[model samples]
Target: MSATIKYDDVETGQQIPAADYPVRRVNLVMYAGASGDFNPIHWNERFAKTVGLPDVIAHGMYTMAQGGRFVTDWAGDPGAVVDYSVRFSSMVVVPDDDEGATITVSGVIDQKLEDKRVLVMLTARSGDSRVLSRARAVVQLA
Candidate 1:
């Protein structure tokens, strides 16, 4: 594991470079198969509309994973993320087309704790809607 990020090198309110994660129908379908979440709303627009959604929506965990990537990428190691949480505030309505939706993830160092650990606050959005809320990750630094 590459835990090269030292606590002293980071500062509170330090902004991590934002990243965009594309989500096509095929991506969702693959995620469904991998996660055993074969919910029709994630793959079928008809079922999604029947449930009163704007269109077929991406999974909440899928959106959360994008935010998690923001933290893990900054930490340089997936295992460095000791804690993570988020609230599903909005839906990521993914359309069935070549150009699908994109989840934009951004993060900032919110706090520096003891033992070379820091709290990262994350924001993930799709289109005009904020899909994830109160997303935070505790990463163990070098």
Candidate 2:
């Protein structure tokens, strides 16, 4: 937690600083092992192509978690997030390279709800595609 965001200072439509999260093949393998999502499409390029996908892709939940990190980081505490959701809108293609893929996440306060909570709308992108849609998080602020 860097600095606490007070509810009194927060405004609807206020933008949170955007962040970029990088995903590599090793990350996919690790996430697969940890999450038990061992689907080949996440790490096997041949299998991904056989399934009609463009190279290996990052897990949807992995992408969502990155978005979650963005919100929690902004709130300055993971527990500040009361609710979070996102719809998978596009695939995040992970290439077999050092750079891998980058998911850029940005958010804004959409609405201030009751009891010191605000709805945060997030935008996530990989390359030219929007990877997540209807992404939102309800955060509790001090």
Candidate 1 lDDT over 1-142, as tens digits, reads: 2346788899999998888999999989999999999999999999999999889999889889888887887788878999999999999999988889999999899999999999999989999999999999999998
Single out the weakest 10-residue window by summed lDDT for candidate 1: 1-10
For candidate 2, the lDDT comes to 0.95
Give candidate 1 misplaced runs (Cα > 4 Å).
Answer: 1-3
Each candidate's number of clashing pairs is: 0, 0
Question: What is the per-residue lDDT of model 2 for residues 1-142, given as tens digits with 9 covering 90 to 100?
Answer: 6587889998998998889999999999999999999999999999999999989999999999999999988888889999999999999999999899999999999999999999999999999999999999999999
Tell me the deviation in Å of residue 65 in model 2. Answer: 0.4
